[model samples]
Target: MKINMLAAGLLLIGVSLAAVNMYYYLEGTLSIQQVKMDSPLPVKVTEASSDKQWPLYDVKPSVGEKFAELYIPRLEQVFPIYEGTGTEVLRTGVGHYIRSALPGEENHTILSGHRDTVFRGLRHLKEDDELVVTTPEGAFTYKIYRIRIVTADDHSVMAPKPRATLTLTTCYPFYFLGNAPERYIISAKLINKQRVITWNPSR
Candidate 1:
């Protein structure tokens, strides 16, 4: 009986700690500095012989893992982005399309967030607006060029482009209370990138 009481106490302590962290995150205090890197992660993740190159990501991420943070300076908002599109992942933060290229890749990278939560402020974005994606590997900057509405079945949202592209999707009718049939896409392309330096000669 004593062992059971100790176990319960430990569990409560763990839960309380987690709650405190989340409180700071949602308050934008802790999340603001969670990801530190050089802004605009370098593009061209893959090797290229003569300019035509494949997209590559410096960081290798696992499914449903929190790998980066998405920051919108215009909105003064920051949110976490996980590596997979799991339902729970979306509930907690944005989700990266597993099949899409990672940040800094010279191709399309797709991202989705729930309109009611993480992406509620996305609709305010406009052309020429800038956003940043910060990962342990590096940081990427993109300038918004296109914002439109499409049917949820639209595959173009995931299409790769000749240049570096970033696509953010959220359900349409931002005020809707439930599953939305339409999609709102905000497409941007890489303007600058910085690669994370992993080598340490001093070590």
Candidate 2:
């Protein structure tokens, strides 16, 4: 009788552990599916004349709202851009600095993401590579001019610019296990602007 009771208790514990593991496995799979589903689709674009004025965004996007997509020509990857830089927002996609100027505006436009996730390929980017941001208003193309490594607390990289500029930042040491001590910064200058006539149906 004692042997049977011990075996029964062990079997119950084993089943409970298996159940917990299955629940976590399913949760992780669903989270990945959610990120894939949230990714923004490519939009059609047309080059805007140099003399033409780009549309200005008067209303700000609400936090957690996806407003644009970042496309790296070299990597051939697209990452959705969310409004805020909160942990949850960065988990799934890039986050836009709320205080910075919008794509078409004449100031700094900053976008950041996790090194291991949405920006995993950012380390492969080189000078002169193009970064394109597509929004409902239009598509703005930027050419990488400078790449630098700065401390995590450095705020100089976020300084205002006179012309339209796009800044991409991610944690340095892409393979670091814990929090990174530095940041990788990519500075790009606007080279072209295009009007997005056809919007993404899912947006």
Candidate 3:
């Protein structure tokens, strides 16, 4: 009886610790989301600049692969972005589509993020929302087209239906009490281009 009680106590303690850790992790993640995004460092991509080729070290297929900046204008916040191509980064911020490659790649360039942390503000997006991706090379603007929901395992949802598309995915049923079984997806398209104001790196 004493052994059974000890085991139960241990299990309870384990569960409690897990909850506490999750709580702290979520708090930190939200705090990060509140930070201003790192503004672009000045680099021009002129026809002349494109003439000079640079060596590619880490050949990432998607935009989120490298140190790129993403902005959801509606949110009024931009945070440091990390790659999300594999299972390792999926739990963090927007992930790139492994098969589709980087943003502006042929066909669809996909990205995924945690609805609650890195992408919690996504729920606030509306039609015609402006999503911007600023790379070391150039900045591309995408117009919000639609929002959708699919089953958790619905891989088809990420496939590009329209050419030159950008897909964003996250867990669905934002208010669910437990692990969600659905997925939320957002689709947008490249619309405008602009030269970002460059400045020296703060850090």
Candidate 4:
């Protein structure tokens, strides 16, 4: 009888251990699923509003996070705009300067991309070409007014602006084999802005 009792006790302990292991396994699976569901989705532009004032973005995007899409009408291409100018960020698409103003802001907004990648056709862009930056808050349209080639060390292109401005930078000599010695700069001024209304299915 004692042997039988011992066997029963061992069975109970084994069941309890199995239950605890199952509980933890299920919890871990749910946590991973929750994180996947919480990932941010691309913001879609629904409509354009005629509001005179540009919508202000109070919250800034984290580094390496994609917050906007740049549409170059002349190039007929759209590039995702990430928050930082790191190598990885530029490899995927355009990078926004963290210290500069964001789209629709009343200051300078700087964007950069690799010459051979996203900005390969930038050399073909001329004055009056439209560059549209669409963010969750709004869509800003800028007209290229000037194109300049400056030394790689030049920082004057980043000076403060009285009005909203967009500056695009890329390595000069579009087809250069190695690191280029000059910087190609495209200066554009905000000509129009439209507020974006994002639609959420949860709402």
Scored by TM-score, the top model is 2
Candidate 4: worst-modelled 10 consecutive residues by lDDT: 28-37
Q: Is candidate 1 or candidate 4 better by lDDT?
A: 4
TM-score of 3: 0.72
lDDT of 1 by residue, 94-147 (tens): 899998888877778899987766787888899999888766555678999999
Candidate 2: C-alpha lDDT: 0.80
Off by over 4 Å in 4: 1-53, 199-203
TM-score of each: 0.70, 0.78, 0.72, 0.73
Number of clashes in every candidate structure? 7, 0, 5, 0
- Per-residue lDDT, model 4, residue 81, is 82
Instruction: Name model 1 segments beyond 4 Å from true.
Output: 1-59, 197-203
lDDT tens readout by residue for model 3, 1-203: 99999999999999999997697557536534333445443334332123212212245534344455566767765544456556445444556666664554446867777667777777888889988766554566789899888999888976665556777787888777667899888889877554434522111
lDDT digits (tens) for residues 1-203 of candidate 2? 99999999999999999997566444322322122433554677777766544566757789999888777867756667889899768766789998998876678999988776767678999999998788888888899999999999999999999899999999998889778999999999998888888867233
Return the number of clashes found in candidate 3.
5
Report how far residue 3 has shifted in candidate 2, in Å: 24
Best by lDDT: 2
